[model samples]
Target: MSYKIIVDGIQHKFSSAHFIVGHDKCGRLHGHNFHVAVEFGGPLDPRYNFVVDFIDVKNAIKAEVDKLDHRILIPTASKDLVLKESKDNLDFTFSGKRYSVPRDDVCLLPLPAVTSELLAKHFHDVLSQRFKGFKIKVRIGETSSTFAEYGE
Candidate 1:
Protein backbone atom coordinates (compact mmCIF):
# COMPACT_ATOMS: atom_id res chain seq x y z
CA MET A 1 0.00 0.00 0.00
CA SER A 2 1.12 3.59 -0.67
CA TYR A 3 1.47 5.91 2.27
CA LYS A 4 1.91 9.67 2.60
CA ILE A 5 3.00 11.98 5.41
CA ILE A 6 2.76 15.79 5.48
CA VAL A 7 4.78 18.28 7.49
CA ASP A 8 3.77 21.91 7.87
CA GLY A 9 3.04 24.64 10.42
CA ILE A 10 4.32 27.97 11.70
CA GLN A 11 7.82 26.58 12.21
CA HIS A 12 8.24 25.70 8.55
CA LYS A 13 8.37 29.30 7.45
CA PHE A 14 10.95 31.93 6.43
CA SER A 15 10.93 35.66 5.79
CA SER A 16 13.08 36.87 2.90
CA ALA A 17 13.35 39.52 0.24
CA HIS A 18 13.42 39.05 -3.54
CA PHE A 19 12.29 40.65 -6.77
CA ILE A 20 10.84 39.22 -9.95
CA VAL A 21 12.54 40.30 -13.16
CA GLY A 22 10.71 42.22 -15.90
CA HIS A 23 7.50 42.53 -13.94
CA ASP A 24 5.75 45.77 -12.97
CA LYS A 25 4.84 45.47 -9.30
CA CYS A 26 7.04 42.54 -8.28
CA GLY A 27 10.04 43.92 -10.13
CA ARG A 28 10.93 45.99 -7.12
CA LEU A 29 12.40 44.55 -3.96
CA HIS A 30 9.76 42.93 -1.78
CA GLY A 31 9.60 40.49 1.04
CA HIS A 32 7.44 37.57 2.04
CA ASN A 33 6.85 35.51 5.09
CA PHE A 34 7.14 32.32 3.09
CA HIS A 35 5.79 29.06 4.36
CA VAL A 36 6.76 25.56 3.27
CA ALA A 37 4.86 22.28 3.32
CA VAL A 38 6.21 18.89 2.31
CA GLU A 39 4.63 15.55 1.53
CA PHE A 40 6.50 12.26 1.53
CA GLY A 41 5.13 9.17 -0.12
CA GLY A 42 6.11 5.56 -0.50
CA PRO A 43 5.52 2.16 0.95
CA LEU A 44 6.15 1.98 4.67
CA ASP A 45 9.30 0.33 5.91
CA PRO A 46 8.59 -3.19 7.01
CA ARG A 47 10.30 -2.63 10.35
CA TYR A 48 9.24 0.93 11.24
CA ASN A 49 5.72 0.83 9.73
CA PHE A 50 6.03 4.59 9.02
CA VAL A 51 6.96 6.38 5.86
CA VAL A 52 9.77 8.16 7.68
CA ASP A 53 10.59 9.70 11.00
CA PHE A 54 8.79 12.99 11.60
CA ILE A 55 11.71 14.56 13.40
CA ASP A 56 14.04 13.82 10.52
CA VAL A 57 11.71 15.41 7.98
CA LYS A 58 11.13 18.50 10.10
CA ASN A 59 14.82 19.05 10.74
CA ALA A 60 15.71 18.64 7.09
CA ILE A 61 13.08 21.14 5.99
CA LYS A 62 13.94 23.54 8.77
CA ALA A 63 17.61 23.51 7.89
CA GLU A 64 16.87 24.37 4.28
CA VAL A 65 14.50 27.23 5.11
CA ASP A 66 16.68 28.63 7.87
CA LYS A 67 19.38 29.41 5.36
CA LEU A 68 17.10 31.97 3.73
CA ASP A 69 15.46 33.35 6.83
CA HIS A 70 15.83 37.13 7.12
CA ARG A 71 18.14 37.28 4.15
CA ILE A 72 18.00 38.62 0.60
CA LEU A 73 17.77 35.79 -1.90
CA ILE A 74 19.94 36.27 -4.97
CA PRO A 75 19.54 34.08 -8.01
CA THR A 76 22.97 33.52 -9.51
CA ALA A 77 21.78 32.03 -12.80
CA SER A 78 19.84 35.06 -13.99
CA LYS A 79 21.16 36.57 -17.19
CA ASP A 80 19.55 39.93 -16.43
CA LEU A 81 21.47 40.46 -13.21
CA VAL A 82 25.01 41.74 -12.87
CA LEU A 83 26.59 40.56 -9.65
CA LYS A 84 29.82 41.63 -8.05
CA GLU A 85 31.02 39.91 -4.92
CA SER A 86 33.42 41.26 -2.32
CA LYS A 87 34.78 39.94 0.93
CA ASP A 88 32.10 41.59 3.05
CA ASN A 89 29.37 42.55 0.63
CA LEU A 90 27.49 41.73 -2.60
CA ASP A 91 26.66 44.34 -5.23
CA PHE A 92 24.11 43.55 -7.89
CA THR A 93 22.19 45.44 -10.54
CA PHE A 94 18.72 44.42 -11.55
CA SER A 95 16.08 46.26 -13.54
CA GLY A 96 18.33 49.30 -13.99
CA LYS A 97 18.83 49.70 -10.25
CA ARG A 98 21.88 48.88 -8.14
CA TYR A 99 22.03 47.40 -4.66
CA SER A 100 24.83 46.61 -2.27
CA VAL A 101 24.06 44.29 0.60
CA PRO A 102 26.11 42.77 3.36
CA ARG A 103 27.43 39.33 2.50
CA ASP A 104 26.09 37.90 5.73
CA ASP A 105 22.60 39.09 4.80
CA VAL A 106 22.43 37.37 1.44
CA CYS A 107 21.54 33.82 0.45
CA LEU A 108 22.85 32.98 -2.99
CA LEU A 109 20.73 30.44 -4.87
CA PRO A 110 21.58 28.50 -8.02
CA LEU A 111 18.32 29.39 -9.68
CA PRO A 112 17.32 31.56 -12.63
CA ALA A 113 14.64 33.32 -10.61
CA VAL A 114 13.41 33.47 -7.04
CA THR A 115 9.72 32.98 -7.74
CA SER A 116 7.49 30.76 -5.61
CA GLU A 117 7.43 28.03 -8.26
CA LEU A 118 11.22 27.83 -8.42
CA LEU A 119 11.51 28.07 -4.67
CA ALA A 120 9.23 25.05 -4.29
CA LYS A 121 11.32 23.14 -6.81
CA HIS A 122 14.48 24.10 -4.99
CA PHE A 123 13.14 22.67 -1.74
CA HIS A 124 11.91 19.60 -3.56
CA ASP A 125 15.40 19.02 -4.97
CA VAL A 126 17.03 19.27 -1.56
CA LEU A 127 14.46 16.97 0.02
CA SER A 128 14.88 14.48 -2.81
CA GLN A 129 18.59 14.31 -2.10
CA ARG A 130 18.12 13.79 1.62
CA PHE A 131 15.22 11.35 1.34
CA LYS A 132 15.98 9.07 -1.55
CA GLY A 133 13.58 6.40 -2.91
CA PHE A 134 10.52 8.27 -1.67
CA LYS A 135 8.32 10.53 -3.74
CA ILE A 136 8.56 14.10 -2.46
CA LYS A 137 6.31 17.13 -2.88
CA VAL A 138 7.27 20.65 -1.84
CA ARG A 139 4.75 23.47 -1.63
CA ILE A 140 5.69 27.09 -0.99
CA GLY A 141 3.30 29.83 0.05
CA GLU A 142 4.14 33.47 -0.45
CA THR A 143 0.99 34.27 1.45
CA SER A 144 -1.86 32.46 3.09
CA SER A 145 -3.83 32.37 -0.15
CA THR A 146 -1.11 31.98 -2.79
CA PHE A 147 1.04 28.86 -3.15
CA ALA A 148 3.09 26.89 -5.63
CA GLU A 149 3.85 23.15 -5.61
CA TYR A 150 6.56 21.08 -7.22
CA GLY A 151 7.62 17.42 -7.25
CA GLU A 152 7.93 14.32 -9.40
Candidate 2:
Protein backbone atom coordinates (compact mmCIF):
# COMPACT_ATOMS: atom_id res chain seq x y z
CA MET A 1 0.00 0.00 0.00
CA SER A 2 1.11 3.57 -0.62
CA TYR A 3 1.32 6.34 1.94
CA LYS A 4 1.20 10.10 1.67
CA ILE A 5 3.26 12.79 3.35
CA ILE A 6 2.01 16.38 3.38
CA VAL A 7 3.61 19.63 4.46
CA ASP A 8 2.00 22.98 5.08
CA GLY A 9 2.15 25.93 7.48
CA ILE A 10 3.58 29.42 7.99
CA GLN A 11 7.11 28.32 7.20
CA HIS A 12 6.11 26.92 3.80
CA LYS A 13 5.44 30.32 2.37
CA PHE A 14 6.87 33.27 0.49
CA SER A 15 5.93 36.85 -0.35
CA SER A 16 6.10 38.01 -3.95
CA ALA A 17 4.55 40.32 -6.50
CA HIS A 18 3.07 39.46 -9.88
CA PHE A 19 0.43 40.55 -12.36
CA ILE A 20 -1.85 38.53 -14.58
CA VAL A 21 -1.66 39.78 -18.09
CA GLY A 22 -5.02 40.32 -19.86
CA HIS A 23 -7.01 40.33 -16.62
CA ASP A 24 -8.92 43.52 -16.05
CA LYS A 25 -7.89 44.06 -12.46
CA CYS A 26 -5.25 41.43 -11.85
CA GLY A 27 -3.23 42.79 -14.72
CA ARG A 28 -2.04 45.40 -12.28
CA LEU A 29 0.91 44.36 -10.18
CA HIS A 30 0.16 43.22 -6.64
CA GLY A 31 1.80 41.23 -3.92
CA HIS A 32 0.73 38.28 -1.84
CA ASN A 33 2.00 36.38 1.14
CA PHE A 34 1.68 33.07 -0.65
CA HIS A 35 1.67 29.71 1.07
CA VAL A 36 2.59 26.35 -0.42
CA ALA A 37 1.59 22.83 0.47
CA VAL A 38 3.27 19.73 -0.91
CA GLU A 39 1.99 16.19 -0.87
CA PHE A 40 4.24 13.23 -1.65
CA GLY A 41 2.65 9.88 -2.36
CA GLY A 42 4.42 6.56 -2.56
CA PRO A 43 4.98 3.33 -0.76
CA LEU A 44 6.62 3.78 2.60
CA ASP A 45 10.11 2.40 3.08
CA PRO A 46 9.92 -0.70 5.24
CA ARG A 47 12.98 0.23 7.27
CA TYR A 48 12.22 3.91 7.77
CA ASN A 49 8.42 3.50 8.08
CA PHE A 50 7.86 6.76 6.25
CA VAL A 51 7.22 7.85 2.70
CA VAL A 52 10.12 10.28 2.91
CA ASP A 53 12.06 12.22 5.51
CA PHE A 54 10.15 15.33 6.54
CA ILE A 55 13.26 17.46 6.83
CA ASP A 56 14.38 16.56 3.30
CA VAL A 57 10.97 17.41 1.88
CA LYS A 58 10.81 20.67 3.78
CA ASN A 59 14.25 21.71 2.62
CA ALA A 60 13.37 20.97 -1.01
CA ILE A 61 10.22 23.06 -0.81
CA LYS A 62 12.01 25.86 1.00
CA ALA A 63 14.68 25.99 -1.64
CA GLU A 64 12.05 26.78 -4.26
CA VAL A 65 10.38 29.32 -1.98
CA ASP A 66 13.66 31.08 -1.28
CA LYS A 67 14.09 31.79 -4.98
CA LEU A 68 10.73 33.59 -5.15
CA ASP A 69 10.69 35.44 -1.86
CA HIS A 70 10.52 39.23 -1.95
CA ARG A 71 10.78 39.29 -5.72
CA ILE A 72 8.64 40.36 -8.64
CA LEU A 73 7.71 37.40 -10.79
CA ILE A 74 7.68 38.01 -14.53
CA PRO A 75 6.28 35.74 -17.19
CA THR A 76 9.12 35.37 -19.64
CA ALA A 77 6.93 33.75 -22.28
CA SER A 78 4.24 36.42 -22.49
CA LYS A 79 4.03 37.78 -26.01
CA ASP A 80 2.38 40.92 -24.73
CA LEU A 81 5.37 41.61 -22.55
CA VAL A 82 8.83 42.65 -23.65
CA LEU A 83 11.82 42.28 -21.40
CA LYS A 84 15.22 43.87 -21.90
CA GLU A 85 18.12 43.10 -19.67
CA SER A 86 21.22 45.15 -19.04
CA LYS A 87 24.12 44.60 -16.72
CA ASP A 88 22.25 45.81 -13.65
CA ASN A 89 18.57 46.25 -14.57
CA LEU A 90 15.67 44.55 -16.27
CA ASP A 91 13.21 46.60 -18.27
CA PHE A 92 9.67 45.42 -18.91
CA THR A 93 6.94 46.71 -21.17
CA PHE A 94 3.49 45.27 -20.87
CA SER A 95 0.24 46.63 -22.26
CA GLY A 96 1.93 49.94 -22.93
CA LYS A 97 3.04 50.20 -19.29
CA ARG A 98 6.73 50.16 -18.50
CA TYR A 99 8.57 48.93 -15.42
CA SER A 100 12.23 48.63 -14.58
CA VAL A 101 13.89 46.91 -11.69
CA PRO A 102 17.22 45.56 -10.57
CA ARG A 103 17.90 42.26 -12.35
CA ASP A 104 18.35 40.58 -9.00
CA ASP A 105 14.86 41.53 -7.83
CA VAL A 106 12.87 39.64 -10.45
CA CYS A 107 12.12 35.98 -11.04
CA LEU A 108 11.44 35.22 -14.69
CA LEU A 109 9.33 32.14 -15.16
CA PRO A 110 8.83 30.11 -18.32
CA LEU A 111 5.11 30.73 -18.21
CA PRO A 112 2.57 32.93 -19.90
CA ALA A 113 1.04 34.29 -16.71
CA VAL A 114 1.87 34.49 -13.03
CA THR A 115 -1.43 33.27 -11.60
CA SER A 116 -1.68 30.94 -8.64
CA GLU A 117 -2.71 28.04 -10.86
CA LEU A 118 0.42 28.37 -12.96
CA LEU A 119 2.57 28.87 -9.90
CA ALA A 120 1.24 25.65 -8.41
CA LYS A 121 1.97 23.79 -11.62
CA HIS A 122 5.42 25.32 -11.79
CA PHE A 123 6.27 24.14 -8.30
CA HIS A 124 4.76 20.75 -8.98
CA ASP A 125 7.00 20.37 -12.02
CA VAL A 126 10.04 21.55 -10.15
CA LEU A 127 9.52 19.19 -7.24
CA SER A 128 8.51 16.26 -9.38
CA GLN A 129 11.76 16.55 -11.31
CA ARG A 130 13.86 16.93 -8.18
CA PHE A 131 12.22 14.08 -6.29
CA LYS A 132 11.39 11.03 -8.33
CA GLY A 133 9.55 7.83 -7.35
CA PHE A 134 6.61 9.69 -5.86
CA LYS A 135 3.43 11.34 -7.04
CA ILE A 136 3.57 15.06 -6.24
CA LYS A 137 0.89 17.61 -5.53
CA VAL A 138 1.56 21.30 -5.08
CA ARG A 139 -0.94 23.81 -3.77
CA ILE A 140 -0.32 27.54 -4.02
CA GLY A 141 -2.28 29.88 -1.78
CA GLU A 142 -3.17 33.20 -3.38
CA THR A 143 -4.78 34.22 -0.13
CA SER A 144 -5.67 32.58 3.15
CA SER A 145 -8.86 31.17 1.66
CA THR A 146 -7.97 30.86 -2.02
CA PHE A 147 -5.56 28.42 -3.60
CA ALA A 148 -4.73 26.43 -6.71
CA GLU A 149 -3.47 22.86 -6.79
CA TYR A 150 -1.58 20.79 -9.34
CA GLY A 151 -0.54 17.17 -9.28
CA GLU A 152 1.29 14.50 -11.27
Candidate 3:
Protein backbone atom coordinates (compact mmCIF):
# COMPACT_ATOMS: atom_id res chain seq x y z
CA MET A 1 0.00 0.00 0.00
CA SER A 2 3.07 2.20 0.26
CA TYR A 3 5.95 2.99 -2.10
CA LYS A 4 9.15 5.05 -2.39
CA ILE A 5 11.16 7.02 -4.96
CA ILE A 6 14.63 8.53 -5.06
CA VAL A 7 16.08 11.34 -7.20
CA ASP A 8 19.77 12.01 -7.46
CA GLY A 9 22.24 14.35 -9.18
CA ILE A 10 25.82 15.58 -9.05
CA GLN A 11 27.61 18.91 -9.15
CA HIS A 12 30.46 19.85 -11.46
CA LYS A 13 32.47 20.75 -8.33
CA PHE A 14 33.18 23.88 -6.22
CA SER A 15 35.15 24.93 -3.15
CA SER A 16 33.40 26.67 -0.24
CA ALA A 17 32.35 26.21 3.38
CA HIS A 18 29.80 28.04 5.59
CA PHE A 19 28.15 27.82 8.98
CA ILE A 20 25.21 29.52 10.67
CA VAL A 21 25.72 32.42 13.04
CA GLY A 22 26.52 31.92 16.77
CA HIS A 23 29.08 29.30 15.72
CA ASP A 24 32.78 29.59 16.38
CA LYS A 25 34.16 26.93 14.09
CA CYS A 26 35.07 28.08 10.64
CA GLY A 27 34.00 25.96 7.71
CA ARG A 28 36.95 26.27 5.36
CA LEU A 29 36.55 26.76 1.66
CA HIS A 30 36.49 23.39 -0.06
CA GLY A 31 35.11 21.75 -3.17
CA HIS A 32 33.03 18.63 -3.51
CA ASN A 33 32.09 16.43 -6.43
CA PHE A 34 28.61 16.25 -5.02
CA HIS A 35 26.18 13.40 -5.73
CA VAL A 36 22.50 13.84 -4.93
CA ALA A 37 19.94 11.10 -4.12
CA VAL A 38 16.23 11.33 -3.28
CA GLU A 39 13.47 8.88 -2.28
CA PHE A 40 9.65 9.15 -2.25
CA GLY A 41 6.87 6.91 -0.90
CA GLY A 42 3.15 6.84 -1.39
CA PRO A 43 0.11 4.69 -2.01
CA LEU A 44 0.34 2.26 -4.89
CA ASP A 45 -1.84 2.94 -7.87
CA PRO A 46 -4.27 0.01 -8.19
CA ARG A 47 -3.93 -0.07 -11.97
CA TYR A 48 -0.14 0.10 -12.08
CA ASN A 49 0.33 -1.76 -8.80
CA PHE A 50 3.08 0.73 -8.07
CA VAL A 51 3.63 4.02 -6.36
CA VAL A 52 4.30 7.27 -8.21
CA ASP A 53 5.86 6.63 -11.61
CA PHE A 54 9.64 6.71 -11.75
CA ILE A 55 9.58 9.08 -14.72
CA ASP A 56 7.54 11.57 -12.73
CA VAL A 57 10.03 11.42 -9.91
CA LYS A 58 13.04 11.80 -12.15
CA ASN A 59 11.54 14.67 -14.07
CA ALA A 60 10.69 16.50 -10.90
CA ILE A 61 14.23 16.14 -9.66
CA LYS A 62 15.75 17.34 -12.90
CA ALA A 63 13.53 20.38 -12.92
CA GLU A 64 14.74 21.27 -9.46
CA VAL A 65 18.47 20.84 -10.01
CA ASP A 66 18.37 22.62 -13.33
CA LYS A 67 18.29 25.65 -11.07
CA LEU A 68 21.54 24.57 -9.39
CA ASP A 69 24.54 22.94 -11.09
CA HIS A 70 27.69 24.80 -12.22
CA ARG A 71 27.16 27.80 -10.00
CA ILE A 72 28.56 29.53 -6.92
CA LEU A 73 26.12 28.78 -4.07
CA ILE A 74 25.81 31.56 -1.52
CA PRO A 75 23.79 32.41 1.57
CA THR A 76 20.90 34.89 1.81
CA ALA A 77 21.90 35.87 5.31
CA SER A 78 25.14 37.44 4.16
CA LYS A 79 24.75 41.21 4.18
CA ASP A 80 27.19 41.31 1.31
CA LEU A 81 25.03 39.21 -1.00
CA VAL A 82 23.98 41.40 -3.90
CA LEU A 83 21.85 39.57 -6.41
CA LYS A 84 21.27 41.08 -9.83
CA GLU A 85 19.25 39.02 -12.27
CA SER A 86 18.88 40.08 -15.85
CA LYS A 87 18.60 38.91 -19.44
CA ASP A 88 22.40 38.74 -19.49
CA ASN A 89 23.81 37.50 -16.14
CA LEU A 90 23.29 36.84 -12.42
CA ASP A 91 25.30 38.83 -9.89
CA PHE A 92 25.99 38.22 -6.14
CA THR A 93 27.43 40.25 -3.29
CA PHE A 94 28.75 39.80 0.27
CA SER A 95 30.40 42.11 2.84
CA GLY A 96 30.77 44.86 0.24
CA LYS A 97 32.51 42.18 -1.80
CA ARG A 98 31.07 41.39 -5.20
CA TYR A 99 31.49 38.19 -7.13
CA SER A 100 30.44 38.43 -10.75
CA VAL A 101 30.51 34.68 -11.14
CA PRO A 102 29.15 33.90 -14.55
CA ARG A 103 25.45 33.27 -14.56
CA ASP A 104 26.48 29.80 -15.60
CA ASP A 105 28.58 29.40 -12.44
CA VAL A 106 25.92 30.33 -9.89
CA CYS A 107 23.49 27.76 -8.50
CA LEU A 108 20.70 29.49 -6.61
CA LEU A 109 19.74 26.89 -4.06
CA PRO A 110 16.74 27.00 -1.75
CA LEU A 111 19.03 25.58 0.94
CA PRO A 112 21.74 27.40 2.88
CA ALA A 113 24.95 25.54 2.05
CA VAL A 114 26.23 23.13 -0.58
CA THR A 115 26.66 20.34 1.96
CA SER A 116 25.04 17.02 1.18
CA GLU A 117 23.22 16.79 4.50
CA LEU A 118 21.59 20.19 4.11
CA LEU A 119 20.83 19.48 0.48
CA ALA A 120 19.15 16.21 1.48
CA LYS A 121 16.90 17.87 4.01
CA HIS A 122 16.20 20.74 1.65
CA PHE A 123 15.04 18.33 -1.07
CA HIS A 124 12.94 16.33 1.37
CA ASP A 125 11.22 19.41 2.74
CA VAL A 126 10.40 20.82 -0.70
CA LEU A 127 8.99 17.57 -2.10
CA SER A 128 7.05 16.96 1.08
CA GLN A 129 5.22 20.21 0.49
CA ARG A 130 4.13 18.98 -2.94
CA PHE A 131 3.18 15.44 -1.99
CA LYS A 132 -0.31 14.84 -0.72
CA GLY A 133 0.14 11.42 0.89
CA PHE A 134 3.71 10.19 0.73
CA LYS A 135 7.07 10.08 2.46
CA ILE A 136 10.36 11.01 0.84
CA LYS A 137 14.10 10.69 1.39
CA VAL A 138 16.82 12.86 -0.12
CA ARG A 139 20.48 11.92 -0.18
CA ILE A 140 23.33 14.09 -1.48
CA GLY A 141 26.86 12.82 -1.77
CA GLU A 142 29.76 15.24 -1.66
CA THR A 143 31.96 12.50 -3.04
CA SER A 144 31.79 8.83 -3.89
CA SER A 145 32.75 8.16 -0.29
CA THR A 146 30.78 10.88 1.53
CA PHE A 147 26.99 11.26 1.27
CA ALA A 148 24.01 12.52 3.23
CA GLU A 149 20.33 11.49 3.29
CA TYR A 150 17.07 12.80 4.80
CA GLY A 151 13.53 11.36 5.09
CA GLU A 152 10.47 10.52 7.26
Candidate 4:
Protein backbone atom coordinates (compact mmCIF):
# COMPACT_ATOMS: atom_id res chain seq x y z
CA MET A 1 0.00 0.00 0.00
CA SER A 2 1.21 3.52 -0.77
CA TYR A 3 1.59 5.58 2.37
CA LYS A 4 2.12 9.28 2.89
CA ILE A 5 2.67 11.66 5.75
CA ILE A 6 2.32 15.40 6.02
CA VAL A 7 4.34 17.55 8.40
CA ASP A 8 3.94 21.23 9.10
CA GLY A 9 6.20 23.95 10.49
CA ILE A 10 5.28 27.30 11.93
CA GLN A 11 7.15 30.64 11.99
CA HIS A 12 6.69 34.37 12.34
CA LYS A 13 7.88 36.94 9.79
CA PHE A 14 7.88 40.74 9.74
CA SER A 15 7.70 41.53 6.05
CA SER A 16 6.11 44.19 3.80
CA ALA A 17 7.24 43.98 0.19
CA HIS A 18 5.20 42.62 -2.75
CA PHE A 19 6.68 44.04 -6.01
CA ILE A 20 3.97 46.67 -5.73
CA VAL A 21 4.49 49.43 -3.23
CA GLY A 22 1.75 49.75 -0.68
CA HIS A 23 2.00 51.39 2.71
CA ASP A 24 5.57 52.35 3.53
CA LYS A 25 8.65 50.11 3.33
CA CYS A 26 6.58 46.93 3.59
CA GLY A 27 3.24 48.32 4.68
CA ARG A 28 4.55 49.85 7.89
CA LEU A 29 6.48 46.84 9.25
CA HIS A 30 3.92 44.07 9.62
CA GLY A 31 4.22 40.58 11.02
CA HIS A 32 2.62 37.23 10.16
CA ASN A 33 2.26 34.00 12.02
CA PHE A 34 3.54 32.03 9.09
CA HIS A 35 2.63 28.35 8.89
CA VAL A 36 4.48 25.91 6.67
CA ALA A 37 3.16 22.45 5.85
CA VAL A 38 5.10 19.87 3.89
CA GLU A 39 3.42 16.83 2.38
CA PHE A 40 5.51 13.82 1.41
CA GLY A 41 4.25 11.26 -1.12
CA GLY A 42 5.77 7.92 -2.02
CA PRO A 43 5.76 4.27 -1.15
CA LEU A 44 6.89 3.17 2.29
CA ASP A 45 10.57 2.83 2.90
CA PRO A 46 11.95 -0.66 2.54
CA ARG A 47 13.79 -0.57 5.83
CA TYR A 48 11.36 1.48 7.89
CA ASN A 49 8.31 0.58 5.82
CA PHE A 50 7.27 4.25 5.65
CA VAL A 51 7.24 7.06 3.14
CA VAL A 52 9.70 8.97 5.33
CA ASP A 53 10.89 9.21 8.88
CA PHE A 54 9.04 11.99 10.62
CA ILE A 55 12.01 13.00 12.73
CA ASP A 56 14.25 13.16 9.70
CA VAL A 57 11.80 15.32 7.83
CA LYS A 58 11.33 17.53 10.84
CA ASN A 59 15.02 18.12 11.26
CA ALA A 60 15.51 18.91 7.60
CA ILE A 61 12.56 21.21 7.39
CA LYS A 62 13.34 22.92 10.65
CA ALA A 63 16.89 23.55 9.62
CA GLU A 64 15.62 25.49 6.65
CA VAL A 65 12.93 27.54 8.42
CA ASP A 66 14.35 27.97 11.90
CA LYS A 67 16.20 30.90 10.40
CA LEU A 68 13.01 32.89 10.21
CA ASP A 69 11.32 31.73 13.36
CA HIS A 70 10.98 35.19 14.94
CA ARG A 71 12.76 37.76 12.90
CA ILE A 72 12.73 40.20 10.04
CA LEU A 73 13.60 38.18 6.94
CA ILE A 74 14.92 40.19 4.04
CA PRO A 75 16.51 39.82 0.63
CA THR A 76 20.26 39.65 0.44
CA ALA A 77 20.39 40.89 -3.15
CA SER A 78 18.56 44.18 -3.09
CA LYS A 79 19.97 46.97 -5.16
CA ASP A 80 18.46 49.73 -3.08
CA LEU A 81 20.40 48.84 0.04
CA VAL A 82 23.28 47.06 1.69
CA LEU A 83 23.73 44.64 4.60
CA LYS A 84 26.64 45.24 6.93
CA GLU A 85 27.30 42.08 8.82
CA SER A 86 29.07 42.32 12.12
CA LYS A 87 29.84 39.65 14.68
CA ASP A 88 26.41 39.78 16.28
CA ASN A 89 24.27 42.07 14.12
CA LEU A 90 23.25 43.05 10.60
CA ASP A 91 22.55 46.58 9.46
CA PHE A 92 19.93 46.85 6.73
CA THR A 93 19.73 50.21 5.04
CA PHE A 94 17.47 51.76 2.47
CA SER A 95 17.58 55.44 1.50
CA GLY A 96 19.52 56.11 4.75
CA LYS A 97 17.00 54.36 6.99
CA ARG A 98 18.78 51.64 8.91
CA TYR A 99 17.21 48.48 10.30
CA SER A 100 19.40 46.59 12.69
CA VAL A 101 18.80 42.90 13.32
CA PRO A 102 20.58 40.68 15.74
CA ARG A 103 22.75 38.19 13.95
CA ASP A 104 21.41 35.37 16.09
CA ASP A 105 17.82 36.18 15.23
CA VAL A 106 17.76 37.15 11.57
CA CYS A 107 17.72 35.45 8.19
CA LEU A 108 19.11 36.84 4.95
CA LEU A 109 17.54 34.87 2.17
CA PRO A 110 18.41 35.17 -1.49
CA LEU A 111 14.97 36.53 -2.31
CA PRO A 112 13.51 39.84 -3.39
CA ALA A 113 10.95 39.74 -0.63
CA VAL A 114 9.41 37.43 1.92
CA THR A 115 6.23 36.70 0.00
CA SER A 116 4.21 33.50 0.46
CA GLU A 117 5.16 31.94 -2.87
CA LEU A 118 8.86 32.64 -2.46
CA LEU A 119 8.82 31.34 1.10
CA ALA A 120 7.26 28.09 -0.08
CA LYS A 121 9.80 27.64 -2.85
CA HIS A 122 12.59 28.47 -0.44
CA PHE A 123 11.64 25.72 1.97
CA HIS A 124 10.86 23.29 -0.84
CA ASP A 125 14.28 23.83 -2.36
CA VAL A 126 16.07 23.34 0.93
CA LEU A 127 14.14 20.23 1.89
CA SER A 128 14.48 18.84 -1.64
CA GLN A 129 18.23 19.02 -1.24
CA ARG A 130 18.10 17.07 2.03
CA PHE A 131 15.27 14.70 1.20
CA LYS A 132 15.21 13.27 -2.30
CA GLY A 133 13.49 10.01 -1.55
CA PHE A 134 9.96 11.39 -1.95
CA LYS A 135 8.02 14.22 -3.51
CA ILE A 136 7.14 17.15 -1.25
CA LYS A 137 5.07 20.29 -1.01
CA VAL A 138 5.82 23.29 1.19
CA ARG A 139 3.00 25.56 2.25
CA ILE A 140 3.53 29.10 3.57
CA GLY A 141 0.81 31.11 5.22
CA GLU A 142 0.20 34.76 5.92
CA THR A 143 -2.44 33.76 8.42
CA SER A 144 -4.59 30.75 9.21
CA SER A 145 -6.91 31.78 6.39
CA THR A 146 -4.30 32.53 3.70
CA PHE A 147 -1.45 30.31 2.50
CA ALA A 148 0.52 29.07 -0.52
CA GLU A 149 2.10 25.74 -1.47
CA TYR A 150 5.02 24.92 -3.75
CA GLY A 151 6.68 21.68 -4.87
CA GLU A 152 7.10 19.29 -7.77
Judged by TM-score, which candidate is best? 1
Residue by residue across 54-117, what tens digits does model 2's lDDT show? 9988998899999999999999988899999999999999888899999999999999889899
C-alpha root-mean-square deviation, each candidate: 0.8, 1.0, 4.4, 3.7
Model 1, span 1-152: residue lDDT tens: 79999997567999999998889999899999999999999999889999999999999999999999999999999999999999999999988899999999999999999999999999999999998999999899999999999995
lDDT of 3 by residue, 7-104 (tens): 55543232333333222332333355555676667778889977777787676666666555544565554443457877668666544445554566
**Clash pairs of candidate 4?**
16-26, 45-50
**Clashes by residue pair, model 2:** none
lDDT for 92 (candidate 2)? 95
Off by over 4 Å in 3: 6-30, 78-98
Cα RMSD of predicted structure 1: 0.8
Model 4 C-alpha lDDT versus the unseen true structure: 0.72
Best by the lDDT measure: 1
lDDT minimum window of 10 residues, candidate 2: 1-10
Task: Give the residue spans of candidate 4 off by over 4 A.
Answer: 9-25, 86-88
How many backbone clashes can be found in candidate 3?
21
Q: Output the better candidate (1/3) by TM-score.
A: 1
Order of the predicted models by TM-score, top scorer first: 1, 2, 4, 3
Whole-model lDDT, candidate 3? Answer: 0.60
Off by over 4 Å in 1: none
Q: Cα deviation of 91 in candidate 1 (Å)?
A: 0.3
lDDT of 4 by residue, 1-152 (tens): 65679886553232322221132656344567777788998998789888888888887766665567666777675666578999998887765567777777677788866678888998888888888867888888777789898985
